[model samples]
Target: MKPPRSLLVITVTAVCLLASQGAATWLLVEQSRTAALATAGQTVKRTLGTAAANINRGFLQVDALLSGLESLVAPSESADPAGPNRKLRNLSDQNFLVRELMIVGADGQVVASGLEATRRHPPALKSSLLADDALPHGGLLHGGLPHGGLPHGGLIVGDPLRNRLTGEWSLYVGRAGRWKNEPVVVVAEIPLSNIAQLALPETTTAGLRVSLERTNGQLLMSNPHDARNTGQILGPVSDRLTPGGPWAVVEGRVSGRRVIGAATPALHEGLILVAQLTEEEALADWRETRRVVLIASAALAAVVVLLAVGAVLYLRARDRAAASLRWSKRLLDQALDSMSEGLAVYDANWTLVLTNRRYVEIFPHLRDVAVPGTPFERLARHAAAVVLPAGTGAEREAWAEWRRRAHEGSESFEQTFPSGLTVQSTQAEMPDGGIVSVHRDVTAAKRAEEHLRAARDTAERANRMKSEFLSNMSHELRTPLNAIIGFAEVLERNGAVPEAVRIDYARDIRLSGEHLLAIINDVLDMSKLDAGAMILHESVCDLRRLVGAAGNMLREQARAAGVLLRVMIPEEPLPVLGDERLLRQVVLNLVSNAIKFTGRGGTVDVAVVRAEAGGLQVTVIDNGVGIAPEHLPNIFQPFYQVDGTASRQRGGTGLGLPISRAIMKMHDGQLEITSAPGVGTIAVVILPAVRCAASPADEVA
Candidate 1:
């Protein structure tokens, strides 16, 4: 009756193998379903969180708009009320969200309204909402308030009320403040439709529903347009709702469909945002996957029943192919990782195909989001958020869009990060229309280039100053030499010249030779000072005597120019320790310059007095055509003449002030000049009191 033992063993073995395969397949399907549900839950959570953030941001903007209206209303009583009314009207026109703007006085009287008709015949507070007494004074609002609460300074966001004038639903924002001297409230009415737009998602995904509700359970808006559901009460509050939490997942019914949903609190305490998807819709993809897997498993079972021996051979071949593929992938990854530059490749659809380690290191924030199938736009947005400075959402969006366009182009470009690293990005097109981008850090090279440019500019400026100095010196040297030569030739020739004429020629030649010698001496002194080779020949000298001697020397020239020369030396011995010759030279140069620049009948006064800082000051003041204010700072620079023609006509090289300053510096003193264009010039020579002595030592010649 029973089968043979050998046949029974084979049948038992086959049945055991088939049962094991079925159990394994069921376990795998269950794991897949669990993973899929988790992923869907996260998607719903993120979507709701983003929607809540957007709604909060919108309220913040509305609050800002309301605050701005305060300034107009707060000053209306003090200024012309008509002017603020016009301004309110203009503000309402500019902001589409603000349907109406009005100001209420301390007595709850409508002081100014944006609506012209209402302004002509100001309406009383029609809705009892504005007459609420619970509103606080002079603070910002964060949560909802009961009906009939007035807010001062702080924002009061009220529930939607039907506008008596337009017969439309509108939300009111009220801020109380003092206008002129009386208390006033500025109110802005926003249409419910506008608030709904802010809560609605920009792009709706398939099988997803979004609803916005007030704290009182009234539905303000819902996506997918269920007219019967709008303005109705929400089914129930989720037990998972946590105060101040970002978002929470819960099971609820939305628009007559039982669904898994996420709820998040918006900026306003009463406002809640909910995003939902039906259970059937959420599991649709997993169900399809399960169906396909079941069909495949049934076909494989049939094949095993028909050809069990062939199935074993096929499994072995499949294992070998998988091993080879894994080995190739490891090699490719290693090759990419070895490269110095950051490398990333995207497919023709602009979806990331692969990214090396270096790329992730350079943009570590991208590592979290840059998967194999991620779109390039997502990566660009991440970069803008992390690498760029703080900016508005729109600005960041624009920057991301620009980056996308640039990446699509063939040209190479540079991007700079907040870390101060600059990257040179180069993109190449693959044969299949994909792109490979490489980023090279070039911060050091860019810094070196900037340094080189700065050095070049400094060198060029120095070279130009040197050339100018040489040209001025050449002109100065040739003038005196030419005069000396011409006068000398006149004296050398004409042996039968009259005695007076010969004396005059000799005198002229001597003067020209003296001028030339003085120029040469000044140049040599400057060189010695620059080279640190000049030595001070210190001695005790009479300051008064020195001033008198300088005045006497320049008296003849002063007389010739019809300028009076006066010396105001103190009767008391004004003795000083310094090189007498250098002191005399400094005084002579100052006096000579004064006389040369003075007009006819102008006076040159050399006076000596005690300085405030326990020093002796010798001041040479001349009522001459004074130095211009613009040229005063550069007067002590070598070869710097205020007017080249005037300095030449004055018959001296432009080295007088510079040499005098240097001599003063060597004596541990200072020389200062102050002058006005039309007024006279005052040159003060301050010598330290320590340098002064009661008596003169053997003075150097």
Candidate 2:
């Protein structure tokens, strides 16, 4: 290429531009690579860490289960040697994960269980109970035993159940049971496979190779190993065993693929647990990042080349540039001063050379303290006097640090003043040994945050008070209302009472009072719940008892209203954990509402069904007048009714569903209502299942 008139200018511009572009490109490339590596490492760390954390959590749950086992098996608790107790039953009922709970004595005998009798003793116990090597040592023991049914996968959490006063190993035959032949275990199992299921739900790595081997170099379980390879040596056991050494983390090429392996020794067992991920698979994220970085670097280089060409042409064309430089300076100053943030300029000696209007506005105290070209020490002293005392100790130190750092060339810092104002200060060192500093206010943001916090606290407190007041009021009012309704019914049923007057007066008194009480009770419960004073007392209760009681109580009302009332309880007893009284009330309310809303001769049906969400569902279906679309939302509000006057005539407090909803929630349950404008409404109550049927043996011979 022929040399141009501005060859020197072109060369200098190109060098500077290329140097800056190269620096930017290198920074971008390194940042992308570092970020990808960080993300991949974090994914692996969290996956493994969460699995280990869950395993530890399972230990806690096992402790709780074991602590109560002795009491469940005591002779006083269960007369039959293998019969269950309330506590043991609570385990199966309250916890859904436990397919079967059994207390294995020191001798490994199956003492008590939660499964049916036929399956409970089905030739499974002969191995663990008879074999010397079968008793689990404790911690997490993963594998199949000679149980021979669906894999008897289990975790053995070996904690000694002790007497409260004696501090002795109270390992006794307490509780046992089986359900659905699902893999039953002691406590909970936190297998790597299960952890992978949660952490990589959609990943095909589920089928990836994994291995768990004993310290003896024998494989316990391995995805790549066959059944015959289990407990068989693929490598020398002694060489593989680290034996209380630090966990092994190895990365190397294996089978033409890079693999990362991490191994940790089991604390409870001597076995070593190992995890491996192929580097090609793990680092797949790097390819796309590299591609983007290369493309960006090429584009940046092209831009710098074009900029250099333009600067070269301009340099020769701009022989006289002092006028342009002076104009640029005036423009820069005007722009800085016009900005909202405070701006000030200082010389190398820390003297104030320039101050914008905002600078003067921010530091009013410095208005008379410092004149143009005065030393900055005057302004610093004024700022410290105005802001230091109002700051926290750290804030004050941070402010002091900013000034010190500012005294150093090219340093930038920020600080919060005593007026609840945050100020960000930037220092730009000038070529002539001067500095420019700017301050921007951030106090509005701080005030807004404080206001939001105050509002949130106020709302939370109000809700708590409302719930507490409601619960307290419910307790106080129920007593007298119960007496009034009871006496009224008794008098109306007596043969001695005059029939004509007794029927009219008794009906009116009982109906009016019960309706009023239901409303009062509902309002009180809502308040109590809002106040956080309501507590749920959960226990296993028969679904039949709840449905039957509600049906019987509402039968007369249904008949009087010319409505057909029917209840369908499962042949198998539905067991749920909840307050019996509250549950019964919920059923009664739904049924009663159906009866009241149904025109004469309408039909109302109630059914209890077991649900997949580990709960019993009580559904009340009715062919009544049905709710209006617009009124559905407000139907559950206190004292609200679709037809207020008509609902009054029907003698309802409108608090029924709302109170029922609150009670259901207390039990970790909820009430759902689905209604059609004319077809009818179905109210469903969901309660967590607490009772699992005692295995067949307890029921049969």
Candidate 3:
């Protein structure tokens, strides 16, 4: 006899649950350790930062006191050192850190001594602080300073030396300066213990060490206080602290224990502030957290095992009676929910009998009403709003009738909703005269068809425009070449023609050649802009001068066309940074367009002024045949012409406005044209205020 299948399944499930719990416990412990290390690094940085600030502030105070002693003793004044010495003694006693203060003159002699012990005996030429054999790095010559000291007006840090009176090592700091028209050095002695105390505060904790060391890795002071380590060069000990984010962790041997730490450069030149916390101390909290999580997970796993055992007994007793029925119901529900199409059934009386989840989703308005015994007519009425909702009421009613007829005939039909969802529904007759319908959503397929149609239309339109541009280009190019060739032939083949006639033909050839060159230049300029190869040669330029210059160049063209051209630029200098030549071309192109479009006796006005949006504005208004409202949108498209026939008569490549617009965009500006059929046109060029060297208040152009 085989064991029951439910018992086998229960045993396998219990084993998997326990294994998963164990894996979760390991992950939690690892995550806790990472978080603990990150938190420890930040705490170390804060501690080092505070100690460095305090030490820097104290040294600054000592440097300031030394400056006062130099002022009291002057070489140019009456030669009495008594008053200055008394003041120095008072300064030393007042400041607890200051052991002594003195001023020494050039030629290596003491000018004024703060301690009288040095004034009386002057040990081993104490007056000569800068003896040659005792340079700062060289051995001290019998306890005297070296050949050179600090640079002018900057503090110098020197090696520790024993005080003359106390026989204890003290640090001396000095500064060189000019006092009373004489060069002198002021020096002060500060106790080593006082400097050490400033670095190591009273709140220092166990398993933590804070040290102040030279940039050369020479140890100056340590909090956990080692006496023999003073003045010892630690030799690149910072390499031991491996960087672990915002701070560092001590990895290899720095001593016996590993530490998480940070090293900060102190404000005082050539000193490093270090703060270290032992790794064991930093991980103390993480260890206890891991222990608690492990115990809780183990207890929870045990409770789940006991519950599974009780559930197995209860389920085993009823398995034979209830398993078959429950399995059938569940399998049917899953199959309905997993289907891509909605399903619904109606009885012979036309009352709703059953519906899948998708059926309620497809007809959301009837979700609450779709149940056994609800009339099918009422559900159809509720679903009508989603089917072509924008159509007339009569049309909606006709659609409902169509659906009813299709179901009666057992046929398929498609209906579109307001949400753009297209659904295909098919109804079949059952053996008992009932109906079953399946609905499938086809929104993606319908949208793909619409997109393909739109893309085809755009491609056709672009092809037509390019064809027109090519035709126009060919005619304009041939006219000039034909004239030049015809005239040159007359001059060469007919040398017997009169000299006056030949001279006239020669002039025509030159003018025709210039016209041909102009056409080629326009095409090249447009090509450069299209390829993004044009670079603006930016400089500080007067925009007013540029606009005025453009008007001058086109004055003759306007006059030849029998039109009045008015230039209304103010005399104020319009300073802007841009390519001066390109800016002139933009202004020239707009004004030329205005002049060409205006009829005889029409007016074309060009003006430069401040824009309302705190920028520069150039406006060209022409009282002539303006563009129609519908053609305004395409004016900035390359080689686009509103009236192709009118453009041929005006003699242009239809690329002027597009190139001008591109140039404006490069300057971070814009060009706008507003027009009506016969009311004339207003074309404005706006330059952003950022490009204007002068503000709107200053009347920038």
Candidate 4:
């Protein structure tokens, strides 16, 4: 009898599954071995690349140092040989990498040396290192001219050599220049150990060896510096010697042990960096990883079939979480950018972690310097260099240090740049020992504060002046009104008195009333000027006649006060366009003030003449006790009296000069006054040339 059909099918399926799993397992193991070897090659390649970058940077720094020395050796009007020599010595002492500094002449003789011993016994140049027929011609110099040639004010890095005197391996960096019409070179010698320190990593994996070599395969540095292997060739030459070159890797026998090797050209010219690892050492970790991966693959194949549905759900959830995280980061960035104030966040390690757009705008100078992972001190130094006021040496360093310290504190402070920009910086310390800083511009606010202070001071001053004027006006008006009222009362009850006494009282009342009327008129004129309500009825009038009329009106008063009054008028009529009445009032006020201020025997002179620029000028001069210089500026202000007691004694309001000036301004003229304490005062009124014309009308009476 035949077996059941179901049992036959199950038996066939089991056989096929076993055969496929055995093939897959063998294929997976082979592929893992190849991937492991590729990973090892990549590891060595990266290591070599890093070493190359470090060496390139070291050479660049040395080139920069040599370039800086060019300016020191260049011709200067205040050239001091001893000073430059001392500076060179100081620079060499400060940099641990530099072994010596020397100024070499065109003939290759040492002119000046930083070291005292080198100065006394200068070493001769090795002809082989600087041979004319060398590959680079002048040496292995870079950074300036090609073929190792150095241009004027250019730097070059020369071939490495053993110093004849010191017996130390050194690299030469030099700058070429002409000082006092002689070709001069400033050269620095750096020891190989210093270069190694700059280019080599501090620590590396065990059994790994790093070698720095020239393009010619000559080893410049070896980590172990084995006595048997020193100065030997470093394997085969690499074709990748160009800038940004790809790293090359190879499997080779080194020190009689199979190893994986990688090589890359340093960014510096004619230099290559190589990294080597013994094959056993390099593949040890990979072998363990392979064993685990093989075992896990077998188990995973079985479990994958059972848990396929659950794996799909887990992957979907992970994708959703990743998308949400990306969205949150974008939202946070937008929120930070929306802030008006500049914001920067630093991690606990003092490295910049985040910054808003406003921060870049506020410190545009720091755009290149302030980036993620930048140290706080680096940003501070850049800020000080770009924004701080001009300072030298120690002062500049101090400013940078102060800025660094200021940033470290949580206090809010203001920083003002030389460009007149001001920013108020506030810092908050996070719970996790990080820091958040916000910078707000306060330039406009500070300016507004200054303006407000000035306005307040001006208002206070005006208030004080107004109060004094009111007090003086009250005393002046009350005195005149009191006398008029007293005299009027006496006159009204004169029926019981004699006719002569009654007449005397009447005259006294009339005089007091007139005096009061004058004071009222003066006040009214000042009020009109202040309110800008005064109008001018302009017409062509004779200035000479006006001066004569004013002199005549004040002549009697001047004589009464025992003062001499004089009028000097040009024979030709000086025509001016102005209101006749106002012009007459202006002249009258000036003449009156002159007469009132003059003492006995003092002279008051009024003159009218044709001024330069075809204008009309009127002068009122007085040989009186003149105004003090300190009081002259305020003399044109209404009710300003040089001497308040004198204003009362003279029986006149102190508005004459101010009123006159206002009328002159209305006519497009100017009133100027010059006075000395004892040398008397001179007041001149200048009318515009266009307003003056040949007029037939005489000045008003």
Estimated TM-score for each candidate: 0.41, 0.32, 0.54, 0.50
| Window of ten residues with lowest summed lDDT in model 2 | 168-177
Model 4 scores worst on lDDT over the 10 consecutive residues at 139-148
User: Of 1 and 4, which scores higher on TM-score?
Assistant: 4
TM-score comparison, 2 vs 4, better candidate: 4
Q: After superposition, how far is residue 440 of candidate 1 from its true place, in Å?
A: 6.9
Give the Cα error of residue 109 in candidate 2, in Å. Answer: 87
What clash pairs does model 1 have?
132-148, 132-149
Return the lDDT, model 1, position 182.
48
Please give, for residues 301-414, the per-residue lDDT of candidate 2 as tens digits: 888788877776677467437546767888887887789999888888988878887887777777886578787766665567677756676775666566766766465566
Please state the error at residue 364 of candidate 1 in Å.
12
* Candidate 2 Cα outliers beyond 4 Å, as residue runs: 1-511, 643-651, 689-701
Give the local distance difference test score of model 2: 0.59
C-alpha positional error of residue 46 in candidate 1 after TM-score superposition, expressed in Å: 99
Each candidate's lDDT (Cα)?
0.74, 0.59, 0.76, 0.73
lDDT tens readout by residue for model 4, 1-701: 24335434544554456557657777877787677667776776677777777777766666677674745645356877566667778878877788888776656667777777777766554342333443343632222234334464334545556677777777676666544455566788887777677655675565667777767766767665533444555454563233244433444434566666767666656666777767777678768876887787668656544454355455557667766887899899999999999999999988999899999998899999889999998888778777745767677688788877777898999988887889999999899999999999889999999999999998897887777778777877888789888877776766587888878877877877877887898899889889988888777777777778778877888889999998999787777778988889888888888888888999988888778887878899998878887889998887776664665577555788889889988888999999887678899999988778755645422
Better of 2 and 3 by TM-score: 3
Span of 10 residues, lowest total lDDT, candidate 3 = 134-143
List CA RMSD, all candidates. Answer: 34.0, 37.0, 19.7, 34.3
Tell me the lDDT of model 1 at 433.
98
TM accuracy, model 1: 0.41
